[model samples]
Target chain A: MSEVQRVENRELQPERAANQAAEQGWRDRAIVPPVDIFEQDDAVTILADMPGVTPESLGVEVKDHTLSIEGEIAVQMPEGVSARYADLRGSRYARYFTLGDEIDTDGIEGTIHHGVLNVRLPKRDTHRKRRIEIQAT
Target chain B: MFRDLWRANDPLFGDLGRLLRMMDSNWDNVGSADLRSAPRGSFPLLNVGETDEAYNVYVFAPGVEEQDIEISVQDNVLMLSGKRADPADDEKAAGRNWYRRERFSGEFNRAITLPDGVDADRVKASLKNGVLTISLHKRAEIQPRRIDIQAA
Candidate 1:
């Protein structure tokens, strides 16, 4: 009897569907978008695939050196459009990254290209490789 | 190496990253760019919906060029195939080192069966803003009614 009760209790936990709001009162499900991060001589660029997201719905925030990116996909059914079915649903793409001290947070720049979000973080002056010139004595 | 630095930064980082990776792997059917070449997991998830007039299909294919996409219909099957270019190509042209990669690139093909009555010949497709929308119209005329040998 105790075993069954424990199992039932675990089921009642806050865990819920990915597309449903259980923990937070968010409207849509939050998904982690795929990303590509590369380091260059001057900056580090992060590219994320965020489909169905419009320019007005995308958000990028940096606080305490932790970069957060989120894009909410808006779904508005036009007249005569109904009986929807299939995998694509209304959801939000959210992802977070911890920035290292070498990154110059103030110098960050971002843009969206065909639903792909590209964010470039410039490196600090002290961290960038400096080409030392040889002195001929 | 990149994971180690992130793990050392915060204790919650490990669990958070693990959970996010798990989700991304499971829901990779749409907007995913998995690197593995063998499995070729589902990429650019699609949605086929219906209305009174026709059926509409929406495919999420970010970063894919229009010229790279090919669409065809045969035997009531709609085939969507395309290649999403790798953004790292630009990085490589310039001297750069990769720290992490998760975005999907390369070729992917997906096929969805149409209803029995759809007129495959009347299908129309268009690509805009990385999203491909295809409209398949239903047969306009009803099937000819069968008559007995003693037709009046």
Candidate 2:
């Protein structure tokens, strides 16, 4: 029984290694940017720092209550100039978030200022916390 | 209309065109609504600190006048409120539609909870440019004291 268990372990190691490599590959292929989420008592505020996005270039879409933010950054190469630093060249950002049922889609508001996208997702009125006062006799 | 007719089948393109037109027209037509009615809260960055002498608080509120801001401290909590009104002449000015408008304006409020031992009565605030700096003196009891260790 020990020999059979050792053979099974050896066979599973390669599959596990392959799965990790595939998962890493998928992550590397993704282009979604990072977002900061702050959950408050009344609503959840999402701040997505998209540095090079212009007001005209930003796009927000809500479908099936899933919010999606898309933006493009243009890094134009100067004419008659050989490029030296090109780390941020041709970079664009896209992000999608599936909101929970507790979120009130109608109450959601979005604002874009100085390349930062601020999204306010208000919770349902019933889901919001309320204080109850008790009378002392 | 010609471009709209050309892309009538492409809803996405049509929507983009409509959005572009709206953005372009906003500069000349945006006064139909006031900033207070717009639902998004203002973004204000604040910094608070404490020292042996006093507590310090700073707020970044650019493009706002010193007269518009109000600062008060109560119950150890500092409240900063301000309103940046749009120019009255903006409503009548007409021009080619704007491609983009990104500046933020109107009422904003920020509250800071001060740690215990701060002297709220001695708090002083100053606004320069867009930065509002406040100084709060600390009570003598909260100041640190160094005691000499004697050989026993």
Candidate 3:
């Protein structure tokens, strides 16, 4: 009874991203990070790849049935070293999902390990199959 | 020439850069008749740079454990080989229903050629947030020498 869908927006799209530019927008500009979505009997798990992103830089929000994931990748250079080449594509990453009522937003949990972000969304009790008992005559 | 063609489609170099990087990667050395013709796609994309004393390489390989990876430089070619085990393919996810599977998982191999002056034995590697960075020190004899000029 529940479903999760990506919230498509222009900011994540390259050609349409210019409108979202700000003073610090060059580093804030984001591209849609690819994800793997799986559903289990009790909950749905979403895994996103955002390398170079620490837990402190990651953001996960749920509001009005919408879920958003955003983060930035900062290349750390040693004190004497200067950055000369960059091919990580971009520094920012973002993705969004629309949640159905069956999802228990309050019980959601998010964790990041080695730059892989895991978001678990549990299902509501009403959405689970209930076991019925037989009446004794 | 091809660069001009790619830029024509999207001036911002959105997806085109990824495509070009895939084609431009030096991922050859697969066992084949021609070692230079290895297949190219998206897997572990990387970046490279150099400091005055050493050369640096950054590998973007997310969702991987350090124990699963092996790094070495043989014959002046830096090689990185590793296995990325996502549960989707294993017995753990056998009965689970998958709505979408976009992230990649499995074994990966990457190799980049290094200049002759590097000290292969002095290479240093570290992993943080799924990105593995490696630095190869330059041989002392080949380092750039500065002649101090005394002001008269």
Please report the candidate that would top DockQ against the real structure. Answer: 1
Pairs that collide, model 2: none
Please provide, for model 3 over B1-152, each residue's C-alpha lDDT reduced to its tens digit, 9 standing for 90 to 100.
11211221222333344444344454233323223212333467666666778878888888888999999897567888898997687676865788878887899887666666879889999999988989988888777889899999
lDDT of each: 0.69, 0.57, 0.73
lDDT of 3: 0.73
Residue-level lDDT tens digits of model 1 in A18-72 = 3234323232557778888888889989988887777788998899989999998
Q: Taking the true A–B contacts (Cα pairs closer than 8 Å), what share appears in each candidate?
A: 0.56, 0.00, 0.59
lDDT of 1 by residue, B64-142 (tens): 8789999988755677888888766654646768877887888888766656667888888776555678888777663
> Which runs in model 1 stand beyond 4 Å of their true positions?
A1-27, A75-77, A80-85, A131-137, B1-41, B141-152
Clashes of each: 2, 0, 0
Question: Candidate 1 chain A: minimum summed lDDT over ten consecutive residues — where?
Answer: A18-27
I-RMSD for candidate 1? 13.3
Best by lDDT: 3
Model 2 vs truth, CA RMSD: 24.5
Candidate 2's DockQ: 0.01
**What would the TM-scores of all predictions be?**
0.69, 0.38, 0.73
Clashing pairs in 3: none
DockQ order of candidates, top first: 1, 3, 2
For residue B142, give model 1's deviation from the true position in Å.
7.7
The candidate that wins on TM-score is 3
Chain B TM-score, one value per candidate, order as shown: 0.62, 0.63, 0.69
